[model samples]
Target: MLRRTVLLTFAGAALGGSLWQGAAHASEGRSPYGPLQPPDDVGLALPEGFTGRLVARSGHRVAGLAWHAAPDGGACFPDGDGWIYVSNSEIPLLGGASAIRFAHDGTVRDAYRILSGTNLNCAGGATPWRTWLSCEEAYRGRVFECDPYGSRPARPRLAMGRFKHEAAACDPDREVVYMTEDEKDGCFYRFRPTDWGDLTEGTLEVLCHGMVWKEVPSPAALVKATRHQVDDARHFNGGEGCHYADGVCYFTTKGDNRVWAYDAKASTLEPIYDADSPLSGVDNITGTASGELFVAEDGGNMEINVITPQRVAAPFLRLHGHSRSEITGPAFSPDGTRLYFSSQRGRRGILTDGHTFEVTGPFTI
Candidate 1:
């Protein structure tokens, strides 16, 4: 196994488990998990004090609908009695997003499809207004904003631009979104909405050298026209998972096995952690209620890497005995008590099936 790690010098002192050194957490003093326990029957290995449960499995009847195939990116949302986790399907042509509702006790009450008829619905991020921004990872791809509760129909947010979309992180305070692309030579983009919490229309731009912003007149065109036009200088090397934490947008590049932090306020992008050789294929990333970051691995042994407040990167959980699968969609409940994630390939290496599980334990902030 090849492993690579490089120390980065940020602007502030380390805060142990408080925040990401210089970056202040949007929320403070959140709880943290005590320890992780072995999986009961879920086929996962957790910390000594934590326990995991298989909530939904592909091909299983969840609620009235069959759990969607190839569960990819997902996010948790507040519900009446508990919460709902929306997952995207990465299958081409038939790809869509699905939702599973869990009670306050972590018992899943229902699961159903939210967005359908999309292509390669890969990883996505939750919006500030309780919506899921499902990104299609294909040429001429677009983003679909789907209501988590099924209160409204999922529609394509055309104004947000379209170009091999991967994932998005919304900064509600600034009413802007930071997005990642799946191409090896993709550009990092940001969408500034005309109205806060409204994603129907927006101005799309890409980050260039010197922290400069270049307008993308037609995102769909630039992606398919010259192909390398937008990737001339700022290619992110297979941009993958992304999430907005505190005031910074953190994302990963699978090709480089690096996680980067983009401070929208400073308009600067810098590496925070580089994986040791064995820790490659960084995928979907999310944060705990306490501001700690968790990143899923797309391949390499299928483990989830945790970044503590002190900026230490370490493996937190491993998909025991699973060799052909990768971990995706690492998300947390709104209250920060339970952690949710999915395995792209089934536990038994079944290509057509996947599983989603929840880990609950004593979490500290």
Candidate 2:
């Protein structure tokens, strides 16, 4: 991973991007945090000395509203002293995002909707300025910047382009927002905003072979899909989650079961893990401040695996009795001790049985 000093030269070119403090990302073959222990009362398996708790469930009363179903990609944002975890609703029609506010002591002080009336909100990135970019996963989906504090109205960012959008990550060093497409033949893209920290307007560029970038002929794609507009755009197999840290942008693709790394400063893209690896069905991704990355599973095993700094990857946590479910969000608290994620479909969940969770322990840095 590139350090701060090494990335300073290009920082001026990219202008404004996110420096997400609670970033998550890859692994050494053996987890630095050790192996998983036996299951707990809630059927959650974690390393010894770690404990899991139920934060919220779909259709259940949280704060004053029912928790949304099919909780998808999530990112954590720091509040005054506490922080907020924002999760997207992958369901279609009116699907949006919700926030669970935690006091400094880990208390759930509030839970409510942040983005609404959107379709299939799948995954989004957290900006350095403390905002959540909620993305719609539908055809021609748009990115909406939602204030987790619920003090402002959410706004749609159409300039990001229209396509089967999946996850997004902001590379402040490059001064652009990196996004993934969910289609089997989708392309990776970057939104170069007119100004840093502002998503209102930007030019969407498609990534081609050899880490080359070219502007989408028609960014809005009013008549055609943006992914198809670029003849030579690199096609990823069902792009999932994406994250940026230490000048490296990491994204996952479920189709070929691989995790890819793009070095912003180096302008290079390559596969770090493949189908034969322990992590299968790779989806949403985030990294630790210590440089470890956690890749969640959309299916298969119901586990969230960690990737150590040595590039070694291993199971960090497993939720039993949720075989029928898929792990969605995987983010750390502001302090990095607690991890927040969710089983998109619970033990008995077909759709509405989703559950948001929190796991706390002596997390290795």
Candidate 3:
């Protein structure tokens, strides 16, 4: 029998037993669960003003998505006016790498099977140079920079190292890139390009503190060591979703239910938000035009949480059946007027169907 779960309330009580206790407690102050309505089974819900329509469906194991602006704006460019690039982590059990592009109107414009026979087509980030870095989250992981516009072929940036990479973010202003490892005791990494606009060679370092896990040096030494050394010498937890702002970067950890901010100047890791807040189950996160932060929840009660500058997380949008849906990709339009995101079905289970959607809002805090 298919079970139905009421997100804001029951899911909060249940998640309170696990890693989301903080979020549960925080939600108590607000009406975390909204009114139940039609289409609840599908896991989608919206406020009175906003509406959501299915843009593309069943697009070959779609995961991460990046939205490019249309030269001449008419609509949000759902089909193919600009370009909608999707990552195929696993296609029909083939276990390879592939990407597809659609016209502003959702027509299949072009496709590329960049790397064949690979596993785990997880989330990736866009560069200031206008390229996509698709990360491979497997043993001996690697990061590939591919030209979605077809200017360059997809190839692994060897200087970025090989490990269980989750997501990659580039700071165009500094010619430096940041990467995260998806391991139980993974480390955060930074790549400094030898030349501007060229990522051929650079130094890699893990984050480390005086005697704590400040940051590791690049070309990390993941040697086996004691628990103290591992904690102090190494960074840990499930590293996922990275975004760059002014001079700091933010990343998520599914295992810890925590999000961290890395200050470029001070070179430190400070906690930005935690799952203990009202926005628990945060999976992937991105920034908005007004500088607010939005996060997607992977667990049941599928909803997007918005974090205000005051550091409070409120329910942004409730995807009716989102618990069964894995919300992965969240990117804003070039004008920042529209937000595009992708949802994957059966990632934690069986069944591999993916779809994309465009959301517009009055964006009130």
Candidate 4:
């Protein structure tokens, strides 16, 4: 497995002291939100002055729609007087996506299903055209383009390639979509649409070492053909979350427990953070308008790792008392004032259902 390979490959150097010591966080005085506070009564340990409020929990009904289970990936879009936050369900058989309309004051007014009849709908990326691309994380998985306002029915975007999918990020300037795979031997992909902002059809290419581009003959079988069968390309261990900011594509590798940044223009890749140094099990990632990266830890003593532009890593928020679960989502509002995320499996033994929350406070400007 790629996860096994990555562990055998980088386990020895995961704490390669000197190489990453320089990347450690600066003193608290340099922190943008200050030191993190203890877990609040709501089970979230956030930064000072920050508070988290539960928006929806599993089985809750909103706008005549019973909240979906296992809310995984999500994105927020501007709406009338507020915005809509769309979340993907990781349930394999009943995989789908949901949308919750949040008022400007941060309250969820109504929630409804936007996409249905999918499989393992995982993390996805929001597009410049104000649509959400909900990704399926199954073998031969697909990306579905969804409209949050319910103006258009969700459509499957076949050209985006298939694999054990994770999340995607769009380069608004280039109109290219960057995606990640959740397999240990997964490859990072880029989809160039024939028409800008359109994902119905495109060419898919995998990023190889030295930033070289290699076209996947049949992206639908990429996992079987190149990743497992022939298996010669350099692959990331369990690619999870991805976000594009300032022309840079940043994604996380869960098995390797690392975050990497790819500069498409320069075709260069660089590591930003390592596991256990401050965070581990890196999953869904999002970039703040300020360019800082927020990463949700998957299934551990769950905590959100904040990586500054300078590469410093700090504990942004921790999910206290949650067991057998991890944090998902982690998207910011259009204005970047409010942060939204979900506890995939909810608190251990106490709340078995999934739940979503919104965090508001003095976010860095």
Candidate 5:
């Protein structure tokens, strides 16, 4: 059975006001604190014109986030107003099947417990067709497409395959979907749908990065050459966050902190960025309207790293300390005005619960 709860007021703050109005009162201008520090294992820091405050927390073991526009045109609330879907990877006794929903105002609106007996709800992405694709980052894991409204039943799109899927992105125009695997010798994958909007009966191919990585052959040959064998070997570390831009797709590897760009036409993967400073355990990523990329680093520093068009990553938003508040689930508002992200506070050794925050910024870079 699905367990659902709604909290219209959190920390004594009422809903229906601006996002920051209640947060300002609850925090009193003091930012949350953690034990880790920069240059070591610390938290995150914000830019000059930006500030981050906890909007909701302690609900469930939060993973990725998907923010949708409210039908009523109000600020993002947590009731059942605007849809804020989240992946609750695990609950102490609830086992593996669960996801949370919130109103635009930060209220605990409803909850759906689906696909029970699963684990490691790491991160997921939204589709252009308005469905949230939640990936299970465990051996022999699967991808599930959830309906935000809770009106439709949740099911897995098995054509996308069964593996340690970290993140996925869709191209509505071309009817193609890209996915990243979480393994040491992890390989990137592309799925071409038979129908433009349908995800059934498609071809899956792994990226082989050599001289032939750039060449394209029949879908059948491409799959066979990449050893597209669906096996039960569930240990590797090659995937994390991914996004599709223009005609290309970009993804990051948590094991190495390396970024790769895949050309759909060329059928090749090219190195984009590889920094040596901090272990780039990139968790989630999203592109801005201006074409810049924002990556959520889930390692030593709980910060959001910014990658410029020229492929340079600098400290974008620092969360102060490790505190286990690894940043994940980065998404821009439809208008690209505000940014939404989630923090999984207990994963990286922080002893706190998970939560979500919204950052208002006149982003420049």
Candidate 6:
């Protein structure tokens, strides 16, 4: 078994649970999991006692509607005793978000579209209000707030910003939404809502030196790029994924292969993992109730690496085939016993062959 002791643990109640795991959680890093077994029937290599199951496949009928291709960022939402896993489709023009209703016992109850008619719907964050922020990863893209239950119609949150958006992380304590841009010279941003839980209007600011905030004169960037609108905005090398737990916000920079930790309370930003670290090609990210971070690789060894609370990072699982594919969404179930993610390009290394998988095992809390 691999384990470590964290030097710092957040206060308050963590109960140690999951984003559909209830997404980012605060808990001690104490995992009692062992090494990977062999590659399973699904071509996935997981740890001992952990089993993988196919939850959805691209271009296939899940419930009735054909599943979307190129599944990207996703989160689990609690639905009664069961839960719903919402995923983004990365296909241009047809890009949107979909949801899979799961029974308490992990059975697929239904599958349907939540958001549609968007472009390049990539990674996004889960809000405390049970809404999924589906981001569009294209030029002048926007963030769409979709209901996981598929009841309410999805709305475009134009005030958030209009750039090549990749992902978002909601900081409820501070009532801010942290976002990442997927450009070579992208800038990290945060939107402060005019009212708590409201996304229609807000002040969009970019993160500057010393973790300070600098107001972005424009969000739509019709005249100038949003990253250039702020004079002192800190530049990141292609930011991809963002997640928040306790008071710390963790995000990934794909170009630099770095995982950043932004201490909201302390007002500081630092890299927790870098190019020399164990993981590479870090893309989509998520955390467990035990406070362990799960980072999916975009091009490396096709592995999902785990970062312990003590900051020890290592690979937890790897896919055997599909070398051309990159791992996207890495989320957990509400009970924290099961994990969900997708291979953007599965067996044939194409968008239409994407696969969303579920892995169930005994995870430490």
Best by lDDT: 6
Better of 3 and 4 by lDDT: 4
Instruction: Give the deviation of candidate 5 from the true structure as CA RMSD.
Output: 13.6
The positional error of residue 199 in candidate 6, measured at the CA in angstroms, is 0.4
Residue-wise C-alpha lDDT for candidate 1, range 1-365, written one tens digit per residue: 64445434344422233434454322112123323355456677777678787777788888777887788999999998699999999888999999998888877788777899899999889987889999999888889999889878999998877678899999876788889888877888889988888888778888877788777767567535313555443777888988886667888998888888886666667777675633557888988656677888988878786776654566677787667888888888888888888887776776467888888766554
* lDDT, candidate 5, 192-245, per-residue tens: 777756675676655554523221233333244222453322222577888887
- The RMSD of every model to the true structure, in order and in angstroms, is 4.1, 6.2, 8.8, 5.5, 13.6, 5.3
lDDT of 3: 0.56
TM-score of each: 0.90, 0.91, 0.74, 0.89, 0.69, 0.91
Q: Model 1, which residues run further than 4 Å from truth?
A: 1-3, 12-39, 222-233
Q: How well does candidate 5 match the true structure in TM-score terms?
A: 0.69
For residue 314, model 5's alpha carbon misses the true position, in angstroms, by: 1.3
Where does model 2 exceed 4 Å of error? 1-28
**lDDT tens per residue, model 4, 1-365:** 22211110111111112112223333222346777777788888887888888888878776677888888899999997899999999887688899999788876688788899899998999998899999999988889999999879999988888777899999886778889988867888888898987787788877776667677777668446435432445698999999887667788898877788776655667676654556768899987766677889887678887776544577788888777888999999887888899998886532238988889887764
Error of 3 at 345 (Å): 1.9
Candidate 3 lDDT by residue in tens digits, 84-167: 444435232233344456555444566545544545657667777766777767666566776655545777777777677778
| Model 3 TM-score (2 dp) | 0.74
Candidate 1 local accuracy as lDDT? 0.78
324: Cα error in model 2, Å: 1.2
lDDT of 6 by residue, 310-360 (tens): 545667888988799999888888888889999999989999999999999
Residue 281 in candidate 2, Cα distance off native in Å: 0.3
After superposing candidate 5, which stretches have Cα over 4 Å from the reference?
A: 1-44, 60-85, 88-117, 209-237, 346-352
Better of 1 and 3 by lDDT: 1
Q: Which lDDT tens digits does candidate 2 get at residues 106-160?
A: 9989998999989999998999888999888998898999999999999999989
Candidate 3 minimal-lDDT segment of 10 residues: 68-77
Of 1 and 6, the candidate ranking higher by lDDT:
6
